[model samples]
Target: MESRKLQIRDLTLRDGQQSLFATRLKQEEIDKLLPYYENAGFYIMEVWGGAVPDSVMRYLDESPWNRLRTISKAMKGKSLLSALSRGRNLFGYVPYPDSVLEGFYKEAIANGLNVMRIFDALNDIDNVKESIRLINQLGGIADGAVCYTVDPKEEHTDTTVKKGFFGRLFGKKDEIVEPKKIFTDEYFVEKAKQMEDLGAKIITLKDMAGLVNPSRAASIISKLKSTLKVPVDFHTHCTPGYGLASSLMAIIHGVDILDTNIWWFGGGSAAPALELIYVFANKLGIEVEVNMEAVGRIRKELRTVREELHAFDLVKNFPKEFDPLTDTLPAEIDALFDKAIEAAKADNEAELLDACHAIEDYFGFPKPNLLVKEAEVPGGMYSNMVAQLKALQAEDLLDDAMRLIPKVRRDAGLVPLVTPTSQIVGSQAVSVALDRKKGNPDYSNPSNQFISLVKGEYGHTPVAVDPEFRAKITGSPEEKAYDVSKYKKPENPVLPEYGGVKLAANDEEYLLLELLPSVANGFLKRRRAEEWEAANAAKKAEEAAANAAAEAEKADDEPITGEVVTAQILPGTVIEVNVKPGDKVNKGDVLLVYEAMKMENNVEAGHDATVKRVFVKPGDIFAPEAVLVEFE
Candidate 1:
């Protein structure tokens, strides 16, 4: 049997709005778009709800429920309706009241919505679980959303600076400040498990801010899929140029669902467009199963609708010769950016902001939200431009800034921002700059400046010390950095006797010998101790063996006592000779030597009697029956 196919969720209405004006998408416009999406074979359409602030929710002329109803009626017999709901919105961020969430979920589900997405900006598990409960109670499938944002603490080490910026701007800095523990692999896994336990049918990774790279997306999604039982999906923005790459990576990692826009509507300056993704996926043999012709038609119709509303003009003021495909960018765009970089070299706020807006306009319209407020602060645009240039590794451009710094600084009456530390910028930033300068951009490699920065802060490698030297060095609060080459094993030394020292069988003594240093010791203290212990052990073993040999020799030399003289002597018996044959002899004296079993037997007097007869000579072989002499 064939495996089940992955699901595709169309986020043209929700996430796509980031690229265009959401307010411009009226009910009638949505009505025209819904049928096309259905015909295009899209399974899930993420409509709206995540952007609803309390103040604006009431003012929403067409509510989320109303939009769902319209799309359901229009796309009958094709596609499920889905809406994104946030834990909170601008007016006051709060997890939607259970009762309110239950009502909204029931209304949408009753109106033909099949899935309700519960998203939190920070991927808060509790809030996601709460929404899941409400959705389940209302008889709708609940999806737990994990949004990707700049984890303030993870990306930037200083919470104080991050909090200050957000606190002054939004008055709710604490809401965004992550906990000190920071997110880890185990943490994400546990959160996924929690969502599954909370009855969420699907777990979606929402790349809200588009910070994920292709490699990161693949690793994260693959890990999540392998670790969790529920279905996994990926939602990403086109920021930083990873749009299509991230999607492909997600597919490679076994993601069960993916979110994409109809065209380039959801992409940023560097992001890959949906059209390109389809083209690439086709070439790579991934069966997306999307209708390209239908998508193209929708794109054209959407563009027509946007043009009629004059939405492009409202948000952006383009030059007379501006052409989105070719000539839209100002000739001065690069120059103005260079000038601001030079001015930033001198730390000139006014000059930098001026150049920033010019560059910003050249790129798009009302300026990116990230740059808008930052432009007002000193060194803001300059710092940002430096970061970008550093990221790009445009060395010639960097060289230009470096050369222009003194001149710009002298004119602006300010000290240059460049310092000794800047010289050590990482290779990643330099590499990016080099690539950009060459006009062949590769996002896979990071700028050199970034590498240097991280290395400078964290120190470079794992360190280990010789066990003997461990006592000499003091414990450090920081991580010990060691050269990798120092870790190779040394050759064992040859010892005298036993060919080589045979490792013996005692625990404490063996451990002490093993601890002996392999290299030259400054004081040879441990070496001396080990040598002494080995010698002592050997000496003791040798003495014990020698003593046992001496005892055996003594036992062999001892004399045998009297035994009965019989005609038949038994083997292993000590026989005694009593008498000898002579003219006259005294009694009770040794007479002859009797031998048996290849050993000479000691002969002695058997009784107090005179020797009557002599029996055998010393050279004669004897059996157990042989007798030497007899006494009476």
Candidate 2:
């Protein structure tokens, strides 16, 4: 597969002139701009519109028709001079008939326009066909521009027309359903095919609002180029960050021509400049036929224009700073903008504007040339500022104190005085230290000195001072010599009484628990009772099993001393005993039953052993160590 080479069309003289105020260039300026574009290899130049001679002539001292003839004669070679015309309003404010459009087209061709770009805000196919027919009659290449600015609501649908007819015939009420208005790939494809059929040599997708995204551009351009036999071109503005993305996608999807500015004149609100396209095209292996050196020259010239215009305060009214050399904006400039933003958040407008001015001055312009116009801080910064303001208000230094003292405190390793004990003393100490550091006079009385010592030292650290001593010093009105007797010091005062021990059993621990009193009264009572019962039951059962085993062992050692050993009770045989320690038994009585697996055996006393004891009964299960019986 062979790769297609992309071509650049400079719209700076046309589009750039439109964006500027009334400062139109003279014929000399236009002549100078031509060589720059020619050197940049832009052969297709759109000079002026033909429909409105009066308005177009307002910018040039020479008539627009005569100027085009002169430019065409001066600029030799295969360079084509083109003019833009509309079937209706050529001046963008008034509407004219198709005959008027035809006459204007003929006159522009006669005056030396080799190409005609017929455009309309609304996609009226009849007007497009009439214009294309006129251009074909005059032996000039016609380019069809489909403007996307037409209100989608005005889009007509066959289904809607059919429904309206059916409703009117049936005497039904008029249905208020809105017509389908979404511009789809199918719609653009159809429009492209229609333009091609109307003898349009080229079809352009004119994106007025810069709303086209990359994915949409790729899909639409791919479909249009594949469906339409003519070459497809893209013209768009830079808005909402889609300009560069849309351009790249269009190129990848097979767009033949791209409209761009030489420097800062042609982009959207923040679109990539022409230099970016050249750089990107090289990296992507696409052969761009634009002269890079010429583009750089244009950029410097644009900067000169921006500086001259800003000198007159014309550029200052713009909301954002405009940079002609998009590639040269240093990363440090962004950091400076951030600093300016922070300074602005502190309500230092002078500092904020100063920072803004630095950026403007660096770019060789005034304010309102950058992308972001306003400085905004996050909620956290705002909250901190509010808190600092509150503190300043409380200290009654709201007039002279810095608005952002906490930021200074954090940077300086100064802790905030939160507690009342600390607030009274620590605040005074910090104030005195700050004032002294600033070379301010500090007048501390004896009472104020005592308060500072008590709170600043003891209130904030581990050392414990007697509260009574603090009271004596702070409360004394006479300001006389210190009375050591008034201050009662502890004999064996534990350091825990001060701030050493974090958890004091009776003070800190109990006090915290008291603060968050339990709300689950019934649940707590039941849980405690259940835990106690389970513990007691387990203890009693363990002790009883031990006692029973000990007595059973004693009985087994006696070995039928007072009674005959029953033959039914053999060693290693399992049995169930019914008595323990002191039970009476009669002669020839069965004392216990023994079982192995499911089979049962009985043990009968040969002679009455005075019937000492039985330990196991019905439902009583035991291991080998578990006692069954004990004899006296």
Candidate 3:
């Protein structure tokens, strides 16, 4: 044992809520726990960043800036306040201009943000270089994260390559083969040193998927501690049951800080529980002085708050009627699963096991996801793919999509799957699977984001993308380098009164508006209207009723057209419309692009047709299954 003090960086407010409840934990719900967390003796409390900035405004109608300020005030300088930033991307999926980065960091530090854990999805030093510089210049600790991913020991070869009779006889059959090891321990060590060179105050090994095993964690942490002058922090999740063990190894190897959460919300897909780690560290003769009593109080209160947010809870959403031991196995229940015989007849073992896990999760049993471990994917990535497929109404294509993800990842130069990139790759994989199922050629109908990724727009992938594939995706034989300086500035929709709604009374509000325009716009408008209505009660009441009637009438008149094309999954803002009324289109041509789930989804034409009427334009928000275009 190293016998050094192991500091705990608490992630309950940000990643804990994000991992467990879809980041829908309200600011008021968080306000109740701040006092306890203040006394909890945590080294750092992560309260902002990740999906929090967007989720709070989009779902809870709360300002992310206000939440940060409130928590900082409540903490009273007891614990360091931290937020996660996605390098040049900030909180959004796409990279913004330098002005956006500068402004966002300035406001974040001014709001009492002590630390900014900055990372690039692809681990590109170029992408994060400016973010590290900006945060340090703003007097906030920039904890640079080397996003973690690993190559599989082997990969199953594609069966399509072994086609004809002679080819079948002479060609290598589809079989498992060793993958060239690219992300070795040395690769991580070099990346950490590069961040240190760039003036990162600390280096963090961010295993977003819990893919790092105990031994691997030990090797990397030890190497980082030895090679780097800055302190090393370990951040991992318990999605695949590796968080506790790997985090313990990190502590044993003299990791300066480790991330954890409350016991209840700590383990599945989140970090290890602070209480458990405190006890284990002490048992191993390491000093980790966390306030157990405060932790207990926070846990007690959070459990109650969790019940109030049951609608967003994954565990709570499982069917309550299933009882495998007593109730008949063939009983029909929720559509999430089928009766026993039908399920067995269809050979839907994956769905059956998922139902069992859901039941176990509902009953408060230990629900570990072995699929993530077996597949060697981070739990979040796996779940994101499944959700994407479900939303596309291609649930049956889940296996095809899942199998295609690794290849898609490899084809894109083996970029580490983290937020934005994980989402990008997963979305692309689903799109590819859907296209292939529809009899399109391989690599046909690639998303614009996917094309950008291959063309090196998101910075250099781990391994360079093959030149031929790059040409196919980019429509040019020669690869073109992307320059951030030349990138277009994001639209500033923070007018005093835009779309007949008040927005941006202050710089903080303006920052929110600029960072996430659509989400912030919707929330800010409602917030301003509520404030106005509170002051002018009688007049607003009458207007509210009239508006309600108008909304109801609009709801009844859903968009109708001959061969209407609809958004089949979720509501999103139309980011781009590539076609106009009366424009001719071919099968697989991207009609319009929408922003949803932090991804720019390209809606493609299903068949050759002419555009009769384009129902939406850029900046228009559409609902699930809303008709987007009409064809004749």
lDDT (0 to 1) per candidate = 0.50, 0.52, 0.79
Q: Lowest lDDT 10-mer window, candidate 1?
A: 412-421
Q: Give the TM-score of candidate 1.
A: 0.46
Alpha carbon lDDT at 173, candidate 2? 42
TM-score of each: 0.46, 0.45, 0.73
lDDT of candidate 1 over 1-632, digit per residue (tens): 54445557877765465345444466676667766777877767776555431111233333344565677888784877787765421112222344445554565677787888776433546546667887877778888876543222122323334345657587644444444433344555666777888898988876654556566676678789988898898886544344445665676568888887654354442223455445334444556656666776677676655565464323443222222223333456646645644554454545655664554344443333443222211122235446767565552475444333322222211111211112222222344345555676432343333222222221221122233322222222232322323333223344443334433223322222222222122112333456667888999999987996786476346432323344346543334543444433444455655556667655656556555444444455555655445443
Q: Output the number of the lDDT-best candidate.
A: 3
- Residue-level lDDT for 517 in candidate 3: 80
Question: Per-residue alpha-carbon lDDT of model 3 for 1-632, expressed as tens digits?
Answer: 45578778899899988988899898888989988988989989999999999998887878788899999999999999999988988987777788889999999999989999999998999889999999999899999999999884344545334446776677666633355689999999999999999999989999999888777887899899999999899999878766766776677678999999876567777887775566446555778857777877887788788788788776563223322223432233333233322332343444434543443354353567788887777777788888878787889988787778788898888988887778788888888898889999777878888888998878888998889888888876555556657766435444444334447666787788777888887787777777666757867888897996786577447555569799968899999999987999999999999999888899999999998777777998999998888897
Cα lDDT, model 3, residue 349:
43
| Model 3, runs deviating above 4 Å | 1-3, 156-177, 316-365, 481-502, 534-632
Candidate 2 per-residue lDDT, tens place, 360-399, comes to: 4454432232221111111122334335546655444432
**Candidates, ranked, lDDT:** 3, 2, 1
